[model samples]
Target: MRLKISLKGAVQGVGFRPFVFRLATELGLKGWVINDSSGVEIEVEGEEKALQKFLLRLNAEKPPLAHIYSQDVEYLMDVGYATFEIRESRGEGRKEVLVLPDIATCEECLRELFDPKDRRYLYPFINCTNCGPRFTIIEKLPYDRPHTTMKTFEMCPICKEEYKNPANRRFHAQPNACPVCGPWVSLYTSEGILKADRDKALKLVAKALKDGLIVAVKGIGGFHLMCDATNEEAVRLLRERKRRSEKPFAVMFRDLEQVSVYAEPTELERALLLSPERPIVLVRKRRDLASSVAPGLKRIGAFLPYSPLHHIILRSVDFPVVATSGNLSDEPIVKDNAEAIQKLSSFAHMILLHNRDIKRRCDDSVVKVIGGVPVPIRRSRGYAPMPAKLPFKLSRKVLALGGMLKNTFAIGFEDTVIISQHIGDVENLETLRSFEEMVFDLMELYEFEPELVVCDLHPRYETTRWGEVFAQSRGIPLIKLQHHYTHILSCMAERGLKERVLGVAWDGTGYGEDGTLWGGEFMVCDYRGYDRVFYIKPFRLIGGERAVKEPRRVALSLLFEMYGKSASDLNNETVRSFTQDELKNLYIAWSKGINSPYSSSVGRLFDAVASLIGIRQKLSYEGQGAMILEDLYDPLVKDHYAFALEDKHIDWRPMFYELLEDREKEKVPSRFINTLAKMCLEVVLRIGVEKVCLSGGVMQNDPLVSKIREFLEKENFKVYTHQKVPPNDGGLSLGQAVYASL
Candidate 1:
């Protein structure tokens, strides 16, 4: 009997071909197996019983790293093949294979890395078919070595032998290399002068970090600015050099045990830290080390070593190290050696250089456990480039340009949508150019071009303008989606829902359908359309965009709306911080709405409460105010503040009046978050919907979402929160792409 089989999904770059070759050869089957753009294809002829067993175990005994989304078998006439061979990959196909994200070093490779008898021992680039750079090193499809950055170096005789052996772990590994032929790391001064190379260089890096000096170490995706995490001076110096204040930094530990010493990780969080995709898990802080690590927040971003170099450096030091992206503030991570030297030298005392070329720049992913489930905050690095399977097939290729803040783009075709890794804010030309290049890079990799383009409705967004220009240049149809609606759609897309859902979309700001800023929103929506049912009462951003950075201004605007000019007499920190004359000028701006814009943003409400409670007055990051407000939550206090629900508006004026007069300020954050959650439930009850979707940036708040889920689930409503993509603007493009597909 003869049969041909086709396997789709993450079948490439995961030893699928070798696994097939070994299985066929062991079963005395003849023919060949090869990788193509579409996925893995195999042909084999053997006894009927053997073939049946092969079919059964094909998926059961496949490689651990491989995922089979769909598999098809076709009967074929016997070709009288005598031997089984692993044939060369084919470049021609529809390119339906899912591209995998870069993975962490496997246990087998880690065992070999430290074994002195092993030939590749102490090799920083040690990787097998199960691990190493995938999305970042591969320049094209077919998952062959020639298509990867490793093509620059030819394999030596010893390594070449391993590549041909089907039983070997390194068989057909795209990045298979050793000290003799693979890429090597070198240590250089900030001036770009080389000092040491290979193992000695890594040892020196450990010493530098131990001595409280900052070193930029190149990793799988990009360079990470690293310093001793326990050294307060080093942490302070990093904050000073990067001009980054208040925002937290991710720390890298040697292993999970080391991570447990600093932060408390749940069982699921531990699994996430130890998963193949080793993302930074936001765990609750336990023992205190450095004051400036996370500053005001109770949680710390902690992750284990993902690469052999990380393993070696971390194993050398007793303390953990701060490993944040090596880039200027509000820019993409630095990938190139020359680029790192030029932009990162101002902050890093030393730079670690490597010859491996990174085809894409991906930052570390961040995940937090909310409601006993892992929710993505920033989806990049180990979690990106892996596509989402759409519920429905699309008519044509679609391009989705995400919002201006936390920008990411998406490409959709057939039933697949690939969301680009986080591309930072498209605020400056440099970031905008990076965003454009990455957008095209993914398209080129998939061999796809858009027939239609979708973008946010905001006209001022660079992504919107870019999408318009691209659409015009290609003569493609273009569509614009409301920002908050796109957020709900992203969550809907994750669940592959087709029916109507009550969406609770709350964020800091987004361009609304009515030309005003919308954040706190309630809509009965489906894929086809939506009806806006309720929204938070509108308030003003006192100084336009400037109010985003100053929580005090947001509080002033909310106060003015509630009490007019006499509101300045309140005894809150925000009111008392300003003099009578300064308050008078601000009141004039707020009352007359000089440069202020009316917004119904729930994120600003969090900021206002933070300012009123004297917790946070300014923000250095996008979610600083909300995060701190979440930190202040007292779950012991179960009561909620009052709010007046008008016909279509959820007025917060009564809540503020109660907050201003209440002397129990410690319980305000809890009551505030509880009230917002209650308001959503109130609106949902009024709408009379069975299924609900919670999305938007404000939904990233753990305490807030937890309470909302508790309230809704108690009513037996099917509440759906983000499980795959993020709830913030980072996930906007995925929503837009899925919307276009429907």
Candidate 2:
């Protein structure tokens, strides 16, 4: 009997072809395995029993990194062949093949790195079929060496032998190389003058890191500015030079044990840290470290070394080290050696350069455990370029340009949607350039020409403007989606849901259909369109965008709403912090409605409460006040303050008054948060929807989400939140793509 089989999904660049070759040869089968534009293809000519056994073991004994999304098999005519072989890849077909995300250095490759007897020992570019750069190195398709940056490096006889031998682990590895023939590493000062090369360069880079200097080390995806996490001066210097204030930096530990010493990782978080993706996991801080590392945050973003070079550096250092993206604020990560030297010289003391070129700029992914599941906060690196399977197919290609903050874009064709790796805010010129490059790169890789372009409804967003330009240039139609509606749709798309859902979206700000800002929203939505059913009580933003940076302005606005301009004279901490002149000006602005925009934003409410409770008067980043509010939560406080629902509006003024009265007696951030959760539950019940979807950046708050989910589920409602994608604007593009498909 003869059979032909087709396997799709993450089968390319994961040793799938080699695994099939070995399996067929061991079973005494005459067959061939090859990769095509769609996926992996295998043909076997053997006995019926052997074919059955092969089929069973195919999935059971496949490579660890291979993920089978679908498979098809059919009987074929028996054409006798001598032995099984791995054939060259076929490039002509619909380009539906899954591109593997960059993988961390496997245990076998790590052993080879440190083994003195190994030929590739201490080679920075060492990788095998099972691990190392995949998406970041490949410029085009078929997942072959010729299509990657590795095309420049000619493999030596020893490496060529390993590539052709199916019995070898490096068989058909696109990046297979050795110290004699592969890409080499070099060390240089920030000024681009070479200091050392190869093994000596690696040693010197490690020594520089140990001596408390910021070293810009090139890694799998992009360059990382690294320094000892325990060195206060080094951490402070990097922060100063990078212009990053208050936002926590992700620290790389030597291993899981060292991570546990600083952050209390749950079992799931530990697994996430050790997974092949090796994303930075947010966990509760367990011990004190450099004060400048995370500042006042209660949690730290931590991860283990993902590459051999990272492992070597971390192993050399006794303490954790800050491994942050090597770009300045609001810019894309540095990918090219020349660009790194030119742009990052002011921030980095030395440069660790490599010859392996980075084709894509992917930042490290970030996740946090919520309700015992790891939820993506920033989905990139190890989880990008992989398409999300849509429930329905698209008639034509669609392009989705995400929102202004925490931006990510997507391209959709047929039943697959490939969302780009997290692109930071596109407001900056450099980031916008990176965004345009990514759009062109993805189109080239997937052979896609979009028929329609989609964007947020906000006309002022840089991404929105870019989408309009792209659509006009292509002579295609442009679709605009309301920001909160897209947030809910993103969650719905991940779940493949088509029915109407009661979606509660709570974020900092989004452009609403009514020409105002909407954040706290209740909507009845399906794929085609949505009906805004309810929203938070409208409040005046005292200083427009200035209120976002200063939470005290929001507090004053809320106070003026309840007590008039005389409210500014109240003896509250937030009120007293302002000068009498500043207070008078703010009160006049709120009372006269000058420079004040009305908003129904739950995020501003959190910021207001945070300021009224003396938690944070100013915010350095979006959602900083909310995050601090969550951290200050006390689970034991079960009582909630008062709130009211009038006509379709959820009024929080009563709650604010209660908080002001209880400020001295029962003052706690937890009580305020619990009240908000209960208020959401009340709205959910009033909406009377069995299927509820909670989304938006505020939903990233673990305790708040857990509380809302717990309350809703207890009432027999099916609660849906984000897991595969972020609840924040990072996941907005997926929603736009799916909405356009509908």
Candidate 3:
């Protein structure tokens, strides 16, 4: 008997084919396994018993990274195969496997590393078929060694033998390496003496942590600012040095036990911690480890090591360690040694260095529980470059230059949209250059050449600048996509929506085509286009950019608008912070139209309400006030807040005014958040669009999203949200690419 098997999903580059070949051979069966553009395929011609055994094992034991959605088998009469063989990559069919992100050292590799008799004992870079680098090391597709960063390191004799042997655990492991012939570790202070002794170097790092010293450690993807998680003094110092105030810090623990002490982990949470991606997951806090870890927040973001270096460090410490991105407030994580030394000089007391060159810079991915599912916060490292299946393939190749903040570009052709790793806001020169470089690298790897380019309608965005420059150089057509449209389209593309749905884009700000600030918008649209169906009433931001950080200013501005013209009286306490001269300039700028533009963003509304309720007064970070306010919403309350439907638009003035009344009446914070959530739901459903897609940076507010979801489900409406790409502008380019194609 002869049978052909098709394996789907994340079965590629994970040793799936090699495992199948070994299993078939062990079963005394003759078969061939090959990879294609879609997934893995196998053909077997052998005894019935052997074939049955192979099938049983194949279903039961797939690779750790391979997730088979379905496996189809077809039987054919005796088309004899003499022996088992592994065939070459066949790109003829849609059988592409899901390529996984790099994983930390596995149990088998760890055992080998610690074994006194093993050749790879104490090898810091030890890896095998079951674990090691994947996304971070690869320079191109097909995921072979020649296309990876490991190509520079010629395999030692033992490793070469293991790689060639089909029966070996290291068979065809592209990143297979040992300490003897792999990347080496080093430690250096600001004065610059490279310490080659790994044990001594790690000890120095640990000692620094113990002494309340901040150290910048070069991680698998990029640099991480490390400190003792338990020490409040050290945490406070880190917060001050990094200029991160009040925002929760993500902690890395040795194991799940350490995580359990800080937060409650469900079965899904446990699986996420152990998953190869090993992303930072936000969970409900069990108790405060220290006041500084996540000051004023009810939840904590925690993760486990996804690299061998990380494992060793965690093992050495035997406790949770704070491992946040090693960059100042808005910048991207530093990737180069010289850059790290220069940029982190002020932030770190010492640097645990290494000679291994990092060709790619990736940040740790973040996720949070929303309705019992992992929602991607910042998609990078473990989850980037890996294409999201578009609802429909593109008609022409296109490049999408995303918005200004949390910038990430996308290149799409045929069925795949390769979103670049998180390239921070392209506002500054260095960030713009980084964006260009990251784009060039990804394009080279994918061999992507664009016939057209898409950019934000905003003329001031650095992304738009690059798009214009590149378009002029290439003489390609450039399409200017509206910001909110992209937000809606991104959700549609992610959920594989075939038709138009209600798109709600509520955020801080976006440059509207009509030369005004946009953020609060309701649109009826698809990938091709959208019509602004509804919006909040426009209001002036008292001091322009100053209003974004200071919620009090936003609250005062909204109150002025809501309470009619006289509410702008300078003597009012709401507007008391600004000086007379400053107030005069702001009023003139807003009233006579100098620098201010009217905005109707829901995010601004949240900021205003949060400030009015005294939930958050001074903004220490971007979205800090809103994030903390969101963290305060208690789901135990079951009351509905009121919002009225008028002229096909859901009016928000009523809710804000009501909240102001409640505040005057001294209502609880939980009641305020619950009421606001109720109002948002009423507004969403009032539009009469049952299929609602919620997105925007502000949607990352878990409390708001969770409550809205609950209300929508109760109303028997299907609510669509961002499960793949982030709801923020980091996810904008993918949506832009999708819309541009349409």
Best by lDDT: 1
Q: lDDT of model 3 at residue 175?
A: 77
Clash pairs, candidate 2, are none
Question: What TM-score, over all chains together, does every model reach?
Answer: 0.99, 0.98, 0.90
Tens digits of lDDT, candidate 1, 130-177: 999999998989788999999999999999999988899889988999
Which residue pairs show collisions in model 3? 10-98, 37-95, 37-96, 38-94, 38-95, 38-96, 39-95, 39-96, 520-601
Across residues 593-680, which tens digit of lDDT does each residue of candidate 3 receive? 5555678777787788677766665687678777776666666656544566677455666766666565332333456556556755
Ten residues in a row with the worst lDDT in model 1? Answer: 733-742
Give the poorly placed runs of model 2, Cα more than 4 Å off.
664-667, 740-742
Angstrom error at residue 282, model 3: 1.8
Which of the predicted structures, 2 or 3, would earn the higher lDDT when compared with the native?
2
Cα lDDT computed for each candidate against the true fold: 0.90, 0.89, 0.78
Give the per-residue lDDT digits (tens) of candidate 2, residues 493-518. Answer: 89888889999999999999999999
RMSD to the hidden true structure, all candidates: 1.1, 1.4, 3.4
* Model 1 error, position 327 (Å): 0.3
Stretches of model 3 off by over 4 angstroms after superposition: 1-12, 27-61, 67-82, 87-99, 113-122, 564-573, 579-585, 640-642, 663-686, 740-742
Sorted on TM-score, best first, the list reads: 1, 2, 3
Better of 1 and 2 by lDDT: 1
